[model samples]
Target: MTLTAILPTLRASLPEPVDPALWPAHTETTTDDVLVAAVSMVRLAELTGTPCVHTAEQAPPRYRPRSWMPRDVSVAVASVLRVRRPRTGVVLLELDAVLPPFAVLDQVRLIGRVSTAAPTRTSVVTPYDGTDGEPFHRLPAPLPADVREGDLLCFPCVSAIRHRDVVEPVRAEVSR
Candidate 1:
Protein backbone atom coordinates (compact mmCIF):
# COMPACT_ATOMS: atom_id res chain seq x y z
CA MET A 1 0.00 0.00 0.00
CA THR A 2 1.02 3.60 -0.57
CA LEU A 3 2.19 5.83 2.27
CA THR A 4 -0.97 7.90 2.18
CA ALA A 5 -3.13 4.85 2.74
CA ILE A 6 -0.98 3.75 5.65
CA LEU A 7 -0.49 7.16 7.28
CA PRO A 8 -3.55 6.95 9.48
CA THR A 9 -2.59 3.55 10.77
CA LEU A 10 0.88 4.81 11.51
CA ARG A 11 -0.37 7.88 13.30
CA ALA A 12 -2.70 5.82 15.45
CA SER A 13 0.13 3.60 16.58
CA LEU A 14 2.13 6.48 18.11
CA PRO A 15 2.37 6.45 21.88
CA GLU A 16 0.27 8.90 23.87
CA PRO A 17 1.91 12.29 24.02
CA VAL A 18 4.52 12.57 26.77
CA ASP A 19 5.16 15.82 28.54
CA PRO A 20 8.05 17.39 26.68
CA ALA A 21 9.51 18.75 29.89
CA LEU A 22 9.47 15.31 31.44
CA TRP A 23 11.19 13.80 28.47
CA PRO A 24 14.87 13.07 29.02
CA ALA A 25 17.56 14.79 27.01
CA HIS A 26 18.83 12.83 23.99
CA THR A 27 21.95 12.83 21.84
CA GLU A 28 22.71 11.27 18.45
CA THR A 29 26.07 10.38 16.95
CA THR A 30 26.74 10.90 13.24
CA THR A 31 29.26 9.27 10.97
CA ASP A 32 29.77 8.29 7.34
CA ASP A 33 27.95 5.00 7.96
CA VAL A 34 24.77 6.84 9.02
CA LEU A 35 23.98 9.97 7.06
CA VAL A 36 20.33 9.84 8.10
CA ALA A 37 20.97 11.32 11.57
CA ALA A 38 19.23 14.50 10.54
CA VAL A 39 16.15 12.54 9.51
CA SER A 40 16.03 11.00 12.97
CA MET A 41 16.47 14.39 14.60
CA VAL A 42 13.58 15.71 12.57
CA ARG A 43 11.42 12.82 13.71
CA LEU A 44 12.34 13.63 17.29
CA ALA A 45 11.17 17.21 16.83
CA GLU A 46 7.93 15.97 15.32
CA LEU A 47 7.32 13.68 18.29
CA THR A 48 8.21 16.18 21.00
CA GLY A 49 7.20 19.43 19.37
CA THR A 50 10.61 20.81 20.28
CA PRO A 51 13.59 22.08 18.41
CA CYS A 52 16.51 19.66 17.98
CA VAL A 53 20.09 20.69 17.58
CA HIS A 54 22.82 19.06 15.53
CA THR A 55 26.30 19.29 16.95
CA ALA A 56 29.70 17.96 16.05
CA GLU A 57 32.82 17.20 18.05
CA GLN A 58 36.39 16.61 17.01
CA ALA A 59 37.83 13.41 18.37
CA PRO A 60 40.90 11.33 17.64
CA PRO A 61 40.68 8.75 14.87
CA ARG A 62 38.59 5.68 15.60
CA TYR A 63 40.01 3.21 18.22
CA ARG A 64 42.20 5.97 19.57
CA PRO A 65 42.24 7.18 23.10
CA ARG A 66 39.91 10.06 24.00
CA SER A 67 41.52 13.46 23.69
CA TRP A 68 41.99 15.15 27.03
CA MET A 69 40.47 18.26 25.50
CA PRO A 70 37.82 17.93 22.81
CA ARG A 71 36.06 20.63 20.93
CA ASP A 72 32.30 20.27 20.50
CA VAL A 73 30.52 22.47 18.01
CA SER A 74 26.92 23.22 17.14
CA VAL A 75 26.05 22.57 13.53
CA ALA A 76 22.35 23.50 13.56
CA VAL A 77 19.09 23.50 15.49
CA ALA A 78 15.69 22.98 13.91
CA SER A 79 12.28 21.42 14.19
CA VAL A 80 10.30 19.36 11.67
CA LEU A 81 6.94 21.03 11.20
CA ARG A 82 5.62 19.03 8.30
CA VAL A 83 6.34 16.00 6.14
CA ARG A 84 4.96 15.34 2.68
CA ARG A 85 5.25 12.45 0.28
CA PRO A 86 4.41 14.04 -3.02
CA ARG A 87 5.06 10.87 -4.94
CA THR A 88 6.58 7.46 -4.64
CA GLY A 89 10.20 7.43 -3.49
CA VAL A 90 10.31 11.08 -2.57
CA VAL A 91 9.74 13.05 0.62
CA LEU A 92 9.68 16.76 1.44
CA LEU A 93 10.29 17.58 5.08
CA GLU A 94 9.44 21.07 6.32
CA LEU A 95 11.22 22.68 9.22
CA ASP A 96 10.31 25.50 11.58
CA ALA A 97 13.76 26.72 12.65
CA VAL A 98 17.20 26.19 11.18
CA LEU A 99 20.37 27.66 12.62
CA PRO A 100 23.09 29.10 10.43
CA PRO A 101 25.51 26.93 8.38
CA PHE A 102 22.90 24.49 7.06
CA ALA A 103 19.91 24.34 4.78
CA VAL A 104 16.46 24.71 6.28
CA LEU A 105 14.73 21.74 4.65
CA ASP A 106 15.55 18.33 3.24
CA GLN A 107 14.15 16.46 0.26
CA VAL A 108 14.99 12.77 0.28
CA ARG A 109 14.58 10.50 -2.74
CA LEU A 110 14.73 6.80 -2.12
CA ILE A 111 16.97 5.04 -4.61
CA GLY A 112 16.79 1.62 -2.94
CA ARG A 113 14.19 -0.67 -1.45
CA VAL A 114 12.33 0.37 1.70
CA SER A 115 11.50 -1.61 4.82
CA THR A 116 8.08 -1.91 6.49
CA ALA A 117 8.61 -4.27 9.42
CA ALA A 118 7.62 -3.30 12.95
CA PRO A 119 10.33 -2.50 15.49
CA THR A 120 10.74 -4.89 18.42
CA ARG A 121 11.40 -1.98 20.79
CA THR A 122 12.45 1.68 20.77
CA SER A 123 14.60 3.60 23.27
CA VAL A 124 17.03 6.51 23.73
CA VAL A 125 20.56 6.31 25.18
CA THR A 126 22.35 9.28 26.63
CA PRO A 127 26.05 10.20 26.54
CA TYR A 128 28.18 7.66 28.35
CA ASP A 129 30.62 8.48 31.12
CA GLY A 130 33.03 6.28 33.05
CA THR A 131 30.53 6.09 35.93
CA ASP A 132 26.95 5.42 34.80
CA GLY A 133 25.32 4.92 31.39
CA GLU A 134 22.79 7.40 30.12
CA PRO A 135 19.11 6.94 30.87
CA PHE A 136 17.07 4.72 28.56
CA HIS A 137 13.39 4.39 27.70
CA ARG A 138 11.73 1.44 25.94
CA LEU A 139 9.28 3.00 23.49
CA PRO A 140 6.27 1.46 21.79
CA ALA A 141 6.42 -0.89 18.85
CA PRO A 142 5.48 -0.61 15.16
CA LEU A 143 7.37 2.66 14.99
CA PRO A 144 6.54 4.92 12.08
CA ALA A 145 8.42 4.61 8.83
CA ASP A 146 9.20 7.02 6.04
CA VAL A 147 8.50 4.67 3.18
CA ARG A 148 9.08 7.44 0.71
CA GLU A 149 12.63 7.60 2.05
CA GLY A 150 13.02 3.82 1.63
CA ASP A 151 13.13 2.63 5.22
CA LEU A 152 11.18 2.29 8.43
CA LEU A 153 13.28 4.96 10.19
CA CYS A 154 12.43 6.46 13.55
CA PHE A 155 14.38 9.32 15.24
CA PRO A 156 13.90 10.02 18.90
CA CYS A 157 14.66 13.42 20.45
CA VAL A 158 17.57 13.37 22.94
CA SER A 159 19.59 15.72 25.07
CA ALA A 160 23.30 15.87 24.40
CA ILE A 161 25.44 15.32 27.40
CA ARG A 162 29.20 15.60 27.85
CA HIS A 163 31.40 15.01 24.83
CA ARG A 164 31.45 11.31 25.63
CA ASP A 165 30.34 8.49 23.35
CA VAL A 166 26.60 8.49 22.69
CA VAL A 167 24.94 5.96 20.45
CA GLU A 168 21.26 6.22 19.56
CA PRO A 169 19.50 3.51 17.61
CA VAL A 170 17.53 4.42 14.48
CA ARG A 171 16.23 1.02 13.43
CA ALA A 172 14.69 0.09 10.10
CA GLU A 173 11.61 -2.12 10.08
CA VAL A 174 13.19 -4.67 7.75
CA SER A 175 15.76 -5.01 5.01
CA ARG A 176 14.54 -4.57 1.51
Candidate 2:
Protein backbone atom coordinates (compact mmCIF):
# COMPACT_ATOMS: atom_id res chain seq x y z
CA MET A 1 0.00 0.00 0.00
CA THR A 2 2.74 2.40 -0.83
CA LEU A 3 3.39 2.93 -4.55
CA THR A 4 1.81 6.35 -4.38
CA ALA A 5 3.59 9.35 -5.82
CA ILE A 6 0.54 11.37 -4.74
CA LEU A 7 -0.83 13.58 -7.55
CA PRO A 8 0.01 13.53 -11.22
CA THR A 9 -2.65 15.47 -13.13
CA LEU A 10 -5.09 12.76 -14.20
CA ARG A 11 -7.24 14.15 -11.43
CA ALA A 12 -9.59 12.59 -8.82
CA SER A 13 -6.76 13.03 -6.40
CA LEU A 14 -7.08 11.63 -2.88
CA PRO A 15 -3.70 10.08 -2.36
CA GLU A 16 -3.64 9.77 1.37
CA PRO A 17 -6.26 9.04 3.94
CA VAL A 18 -5.75 6.26 6.41
CA ASP A 19 -3.81 3.41 4.93
CA PRO A 20 -3.18 1.09 7.84
CA ALA A 21 -2.31 -1.65 5.41
CA LEU A 22 -5.98 -1.31 4.55
CA TRP A 23 -7.24 -2.33 7.96
CA PRO A 24 -8.68 -5.53 9.42
CA ALA A 25 -6.25 -8.23 10.20
CA HIS A 26 -8.20 -8.07 13.37
CA THR A 27 -8.46 -4.32 13.48
CA GLU A 28 -7.83 -2.70 16.81
CA THR A 29 -7.60 1.01 17.56
CA THR A 30 -8.64 1.97 21.02
CA THR A 31 -8.20 5.48 22.21
CA ASP A 32 -11.82 5.81 21.50
CA ASP A 33 -12.85 2.58 19.81
CA VAL A 34 -12.69 0.48 16.63
CA LEU A 35 -11.99 -3.03 17.70
CA VAL A 36 -12.90 -6.08 15.70
CA ALA A 37 -12.15 -9.46 17.16
CA ALA A 38 -12.14 -8.08 20.62
CA VAL A 39 -15.36 -6.51 19.51
CA SER A 40 -16.15 -2.93 20.41
CA MET A 41 -17.06 -1.20 17.20
CA VAL A 42 -18.61 1.54 19.26
CA ARG A 43 -19.71 -1.23 21.57
CA LEU A 44 -21.06 -3.14 18.63
CA ALA A 45 -22.91 -0.08 17.50
CA GLU A 46 -24.51 0.49 20.88
CA LEU A 47 -25.57 -3.14 20.98
CA THR A 48 -26.68 -4.02 17.49
CA GLY A 49 -28.16 -0.91 16.02
CA THR A 50 -26.59 1.55 13.59
CA PRO A 51 -25.89 -0.82 10.72
CA CYS A 52 -23.59 -2.94 12.76
CA VAL A 53 -21.26 -5.42 11.10
CA HIS A 54 -18.38 -7.13 12.85
CA THR A 55 -17.01 -10.40 11.62
CA ALA A 56 -13.95 -12.63 11.68
CA GLU A 57 -13.88 -16.36 11.70
CA GLN A 58 -10.25 -16.28 10.71
CA ALA A 59 -7.36 -13.87 10.43
CA PRO A 60 -3.86 -13.83 8.99
CA PRO A 61 -3.46 -12.58 5.45
CA ARG A 62 -2.11 -9.09 5.16
CA TYR A 63 -0.83 -9.37 1.60
CA ARG A 64 -1.13 -6.36 -0.72
CA PRO A 65 2.20 -4.73 -1.46
CA ARG A 66 1.14 -4.99 -5.08
CA SER A 67 -2.09 -6.86 -4.43
CA TRP A 68 -2.83 -10.54 -4.49
CA MET A 69 -5.97 -9.94 -2.42
CA PRO A 70 -5.66 -10.75 1.25
CA ARG A 71 -6.08 -7.80 3.50
CA ASP A 72 -9.82 -7.68 3.60
CA VAL A 73 -12.22 -6.55 6.27
CA SER A 74 -15.09 -7.36 4.00
CA VAL A 75 -13.23 -5.26 1.44
CA ALA A 76 -12.54 -2.74 4.13
CA VAL A 77 -15.95 -1.46 5.09
CA ALA A 78 -17.01 -1.23 1.44
CA SER A 79 -18.35 1.95 -0.17
CA VAL A 80 -18.18 3.01 -3.78
CA LEU A 81 -19.27 6.00 -5.83
CA ARG A 82 -16.01 7.65 -6.64
CA VAL A 83 -15.83 10.09 -9.53
CA ARG A 84 -15.22 13.58 -8.37
CA ARG A 85 -12.96 16.22 -9.82
CA PRO A 86 -14.74 19.29 -8.50
CA ARG A 87 -12.42 21.35 -10.71
CA THR A 88 -10.63 20.34 -13.83
CA GLY A 89 -11.31 19.61 -17.48
CA VAL A 90 -14.13 17.41 -16.19
CA VAL A 91 -14.65 13.63 -16.52
CA LEU A 92 -16.87 11.22 -14.62
CA LEU A 93 -19.12 8.75 -16.37
CA GLU A 94 -19.16 5.86 -13.89
CA LEU A 95 -18.40 4.13 -17.18
CA ASP A 96 -20.36 1.16 -16.00
CA ALA A 97 -17.93 1.37 -13.08
CA VAL A 98 -16.46 -1.68 -11.39
CA LEU A 99 -13.11 -2.05 -9.64
CA PRO A 100 -13.57 -4.28 -6.69
CA PRO A 101 -10.41 -5.87 -5.26
CA PHE A 102 -9.57 -7.41 -8.61
CA ALA A 103 -7.02 -5.65 -10.82
CA VAL A 104 -6.76 -4.02 -14.25
CA LEU A 105 -6.20 -0.36 -14.79
CA ASP A 106 -2.61 -1.27 -15.74
CA GLN A 107 0.21 1.13 -14.79
CA VAL A 108 0.99 0.83 -11.11
CA ARG A 109 4.58 1.68 -10.42
CA LEU A 110 3.85 4.90 -8.63
CA ILE A 111 0.14 4.09 -8.36
CA GLY A 112 -2.25 5.94 -10.69
CA ARG A 113 -5.25 4.26 -12.29
CA VAL A 114 -6.53 1.53 -9.94
CA SER A 115 -9.66 0.25 -11.63
CA THR A 116 -10.05 -3.55 -11.51
CA ALA A 117 -11.45 -4.02 -15.01
CA ALA A 118 -14.84 -5.11 -16.25
CA PRO A 119 -13.86 -5.58 -19.88
CA THR A 120 -11.64 -2.58 -20.41
CA ARG A 121 -12.91 0.82 -21.54
CA THR A 122 -10.97 3.50 -19.67
CA SER A 123 -8.87 6.15 -21.36
CA VAL A 124 -8.11 9.68 -20.28
CA VAL A 125 -7.05 12.89 -22.07
CA THR A 126 -9.63 15.62 -22.30
CA PRO A 127 -9.83 18.90 -24.18
CA TYR A 128 -12.21 19.49 -27.08
CA ASP A 129 -13.75 22.84 -27.42
CA GLY A 130 -13.23 23.45 -31.08
CA THR A 131 -13.90 26.61 -29.13
CA ASP A 132 -17.11 24.94 -27.96
CA GLY A 133 -18.61 21.95 -29.64
CA GLU A 134 -20.05 20.05 -26.66
CA PRO A 135 -19.88 16.26 -26.52
CA PHE A 136 -18.31 14.51 -23.59
CA HIS A 137 -20.61 11.96 -22.07
CA ARG A 138 -23.51 9.66 -22.95
CA LEU A 139 -23.84 5.88 -22.85
CA PRO A 140 -25.85 3.21 -21.12
CA ALA A 141 -28.87 0.93 -21.68
CA PRO A 142 -27.35 -2.28 -23.01
CA LEU A 143 -24.66 -0.46 -24.95
CA PRO A 144 -21.13 -1.67 -24.40
CA ALA A 145 -20.41 -4.08 -27.18
CA ASP A 146 -18.07 -1.33 -28.31
CA VAL A 147 -18.98 1.73 -30.29
CA ARG A 148 -16.83 3.94 -32.43
CA GLU A 149 -16.56 7.34 -34.11
CA GLY A 150 -12.92 8.20 -34.07
CA ASP A 151 -13.15 6.59 -30.59
CA LEU A 152 -10.57 8.70 -28.63
CA LEU A 153 -12.77 8.35 -25.56
CA CYS A 154 -12.00 8.70 -21.85
CA PHE A 155 -13.69 9.17 -18.48
CA PRO A 156 -12.46 8.95 -14.87
CA CYS A 157 -12.06 11.50 -12.19
CA VAL A 158 -12.66 9.16 -9.27
CA SER A 159 -11.80 11.28 -6.32
CA ALA A 160 -11.75 8.17 -4.19
CA ILE A 161 -11.92 4.41 -4.74
CA ARG A 162 -8.85 3.05 -2.92
CA HIS A 163 -8.84 -0.53 -4.17
CA ARG A 164 -6.48 -1.34 -1.40
CA ASP A 165 -9.52 0.80 -0.21
CA VAL A 166 -12.64 2.85 1.07
CA VAL A 167 -14.99 3.42 3.56
CA GLU A 168 -12.73 6.44 4.09
CA PRO A 169 -14.70 9.53 4.81
CA VAL A 170 -15.14 10.35 8.45
CA ARG A 171 -12.92 13.29 9.12
CA ALA A 172 -13.34 12.87 12.86
CA GLU A 173 -16.36 13.39 15.02
CA VAL A 174 -17.50 10.38 17.00
CA SER A 175 -17.99 9.65 20.63
CA ARG A 176 -19.44 6.78 22.61
Candidate 3:
Protein backbone atom coordinates (compact mmCIF):
# COMPACT_ATOMS: atom_id res chain seq x y z
CA MET A 1 0.00 0.00 0.00
CA THR A 2 1.20 3.49 -0.80
CA LEU A 3 0.27 6.84 0.72
CA THR A 4 -1.38 7.90 -2.54
CA ALA A 5 -4.24 5.47 -2.04
CA ILE A 6 -5.09 6.87 1.40
CA LEU A 7 -5.48 10.51 0.29
CA PRO A 8 -8.64 9.97 -1.69
CA THR A 9 -9.99 7.68 0.97
CA LEU A 10 -9.51 10.45 3.52
CA ARG A 11 -11.14 13.06 1.32
CA ALA A 12 -14.00 10.75 0.48
CA SER A 13 -14.76 10.64 4.18
CA LEU A 14 -15.22 14.38 4.53
CA PRO A 15 -18.69 15.48 5.57
CA GLU A 16 -20.36 17.59 2.92
CA PRO A 17 -20.07 21.36 3.32
CA VAL A 18 -22.28 22.05 6.37
CA ASP A 19 -22.11 23.19 9.92
CA PRO A 20 -19.62 21.09 11.90
CA ALA A 21 -21.59 21.60 15.09
CA LEU A 22 -24.00 18.94 13.84
CA TRP A 23 -21.22 16.32 13.57
CA PRO A 24 -21.62 14.94 17.07
CA ALA A 25 -25.31 14.27 16.49
CA HIS A 26 -24.72 12.75 13.04
CA THR A 27 -24.85 8.99 13.04
CA GLU A 28 -23.44 6.31 10.71
CA THR A 29 -25.12 2.96 10.11
CA THR A 30 -22.20 0.79 11.26
CA THR A 31 -19.07 0.90 13.44
CA ASP A 32 -16.81 0.45 10.39
CA ASP A 33 -18.58 3.22 8.53
CA VAL A 34 -18.31 5.50 11.52
CA LEU A 35 -14.58 4.83 11.94
CA VAL A 36 -13.72 5.70 8.35
CA ALA A 37 -15.93 8.78 8.51
CA ALA A 38 -14.36 9.90 11.76
CA VAL A 39 -10.75 9.43 10.64
CA SER A 40 -11.26 11.28 7.35
CA MET A 41 -13.22 14.12 8.90
CA VAL A 42 -10.79 14.60 11.77
CA ARG A 43 -7.70 14.39 9.56
CA LEU A 44 -9.13 17.01 7.21
CA ALA A 45 -9.81 19.37 10.07
CA GLU A 46 -6.25 19.13 11.33
CA LEU A 47 -4.75 19.72 7.89
CA THR A 48 -6.62 22.99 7.60
CA GLY A 49 -5.66 24.12 11.10
CA THR A 50 -9.36 24.75 11.64
CA PRO A 51 -11.75 23.50 14.25
CA CYS A 52 -13.84 20.66 12.89
CA VAL A 53 -17.33 21.89 12.07
CA HIS A 54 -20.19 20.69 9.98
CA THR A 55 -19.08 23.23 7.35
CA ALA A 56 -15.53 24.50 6.93
CA GLU A 57 -14.35 27.37 4.75
CA GLN A 58 -11.83 25.25 2.84
CA ALA A 59 -10.90 21.63 2.47
CA PRO A 60 -7.59 20.41 3.87
CA PRO A 61 -4.78 19.99 1.37
CA ARG A 62 -4.57 16.48 0.03
CA TYR A 63 -2.07 14.23 1.79
CA ARG A 64 0.94 13.23 -0.29
CA PRO A 65 1.70 9.58 -0.64
CA ARG A 66 4.07 8.60 2.16
CA SER A 67 4.27 6.24 5.04
CA TRP A 68 2.42 8.08 7.84
CA MET A 69 2.96 7.12 11.45
CA PRO A 70 0.80 7.74 14.51
CA ARG A 71 2.67 11.04 14.94
CA ASP A 72 1.55 12.20 11.52
CA VAL A 73 -1.99 11.72 12.69
CA SER A 74 -1.52 13.76 15.91
CA VAL A 75 -2.28 17.17 14.43
CA ALA A 76 -5.63 15.88 13.27
CA VAL A 77 -6.15 14.32 16.68
CA ALA A 78 -5.63 17.64 18.44
CA SER A 79 -7.77 19.43 15.88
CA VAL A 80 -10.53 16.93 16.61
CA LEU A 81 -10.32 17.70 20.34
CA ARG A 82 -9.58 21.41 20.05
CA VAL A 83 -13.07 22.13 21.38
CA ARG A 84 -12.45 20.09 24.53
CA ARG A 85 -8.95 21.53 25.08
CA PRO A 86 -7.83 18.62 27.17
CA ARG A 87 -6.44 20.25 30.31
CA THR A 88 -5.00 16.86 31.20
CA GLY A 89 -3.05 16.67 27.87
CA VAL A 90 -2.87 13.83 25.32
CA VAL A 91 -0.33 11.43 23.77
CA LEU A 92 -0.52 10.51 20.06
CA LEU A 93 0.94 7.23 18.86
CA GLU A 94 1.10 5.84 15.30
CA LEU A 95 -0.19 2.35 14.71
CA ASP A 96 0.81 -0.20 12.06
CA ALA A 97 -0.27 -0.01 8.42
CA VAL A 98 0.48 -2.64 5.85
CA LEU A 99 1.81 -1.59 2.46
CA PRO A 100 -1.29 -0.98 0.37
CA PRO A 101 -2.31 1.17 -2.57
CA PHE A 102 -2.75 4.67 -1.08
CA ALA A 103 -3.18 8.08 -2.62
CA VAL A 104 -0.74 10.92 -2.08
CA LEU A 105 -1.95 14.35 -1.14
CA ASP A 106 0.29 16.48 1.08
CA GLN A 107 2.77 15.79 3.79
CA VAL A 108 1.29 15.47 7.29
CA ARG A 109 2.69 17.65 10.05
CA LEU A 110 2.34 17.47 13.85
CA ILE A 111 1.72 20.25 16.37
CA GLY A 112 3.50 19.56 19.64
CA ARG A 113 4.85 21.39 22.67
CA VAL A 114 8.48 21.79 23.77
CA SER A 115 9.33 20.50 27.20
CA THR A 116 12.41 20.80 29.35
CA ALA A 117 13.87 17.90 31.24
CA ALA A 118 13.27 19.86 34.43
CA PRO A 119 9.51 19.51 34.14
CA THR A 120 10.25 15.81 33.54
CA ARG A 121 6.65 14.59 33.71
CA THR A 122 3.78 15.47 31.41
CA SER A 123 1.07 17.17 33.52
CA VAL A 124 -1.68 19.64 32.87
CA VAL A 125 -1.04 23.07 34.34
CA THR A 126 -4.15 25.21 34.40
CA PRO A 127 -3.82 28.92 34.86
CA TYR A 128 -5.73 30.19 37.85
CA ASP A 129 -8.28 32.92 37.48
CA GLY A 130 -7.36 36.03 39.48
CA THR A 131 -10.90 35.98 40.88
CA ASP A 132 -10.02 32.76 42.72
CA GLY A 133 -6.70 34.20 43.99
CA GLU A 134 -4.63 31.12 43.21
CA PRO A 135 -1.98 31.71 40.57
CA PHE A 136 -2.11 28.22 38.98
CA HIS A 137 -3.78 24.86 39.29
CA ARG A 138 -2.11 21.55 38.42
CA LEU A 139 -4.15 18.58 37.35
CA PRO A 140 -3.66 15.29 39.13
CA ALA A 141 -1.85 12.39 37.43
CA PRO A 142 0.84 13.23 34.89
CA LEU A 143 0.84 11.78 31.38
CA PRO A 144 2.55 8.44 31.01
CA ALA A 145 6.30 8.48 31.69
CA ASP A 146 6.98 7.23 28.18
CA VAL A 147 5.40 10.34 26.68
CA ARG A 148 8.30 12.59 25.65
CA GLU A 149 8.56 16.07 24.23
CA GLY A 150 7.68 16.48 20.53
CA ASP A 151 5.34 13.51 20.77
CA LEU A 152 1.88 14.07 19.27
CA LEU A 153 -0.89 13.45 21.79
CA CYS A 154 -4.23 13.23 20.04
CA PHE A 155 -7.52 13.15 21.99
CA PRO A 156 -10.15 11.90 19.60
CA CYS A 157 -13.91 11.80 20.38
CA VAL A 158 -13.82 8.07 20.88
CA SER A 159 -11.48 5.88 22.93
CA ALA A 160 -8.62 7.89 24.49
CA ILE A 161 -6.22 5.04 23.87
CA ARG A 162 -6.64 5.25 20.09
CA HIS A 163 -3.51 7.34 19.36
CA ARG A 164 -1.04 7.31 16.43
CA ASP A 165 2.05 9.22 15.24
CA VAL A 166 4.45 9.95 12.32
CA VAL A 167 8.23 9.86 12.30
CA GLU A 168 9.13 13.52 12.06
CA PRO A 169 10.01 16.57 14.09
CA VAL A 170 6.68 17.28 15.78
CA ARG A 171 6.35 20.97 16.44
CA ALA A 172 3.92 22.12 19.14
CA GLU A 173 1.32 24.58 17.92
CA VAL A 174 -0.92 25.11 20.93
CA SER A 175 -4.11 26.92 20.07
CA ARG A 176 -4.99 30.13 21.81
lDDT of each: 0.31, 0.30, 0.27
Candidate 3 residue lDDT tens string, 1-176: 22222332332333212222222233221211222244444344446433222221222334634653222121122221212223434432221111111201121212233221121123332233246643322322232333433243322221111122222224588998
Off by over 4 Å in 1: 1-49, 54-57, 63-69, 75-77, 102-176
Ten contiguous residues minimizing lDDT sum, candidate 2: 149-158
Over 25-117, each residue of candidate 2 has an lDDT whose tens digit, in order, gives 565543234455576545444464322234343344455355454433432221112333334333233322232333212311111123221
lDDT of 3 at 12: 31
Instruction: For model 1, name the residue pairs that clash.
Output: 25-159, 26-158, 26-159
RMSD of each: 17.7, 17.6, 18.5
Q: State the TM-score for model 1.
A: 0.28
Output the number of the lDDT-best candidate: 1
lDDT of 1: 0.31
Q: Clashes per prediction?
A: 3, 2, 45
Over the stretch 93-150, how does candidate 1's per-residue lDDT look in tens digits?
4433322222211211111222333322223222233556434323333223343222
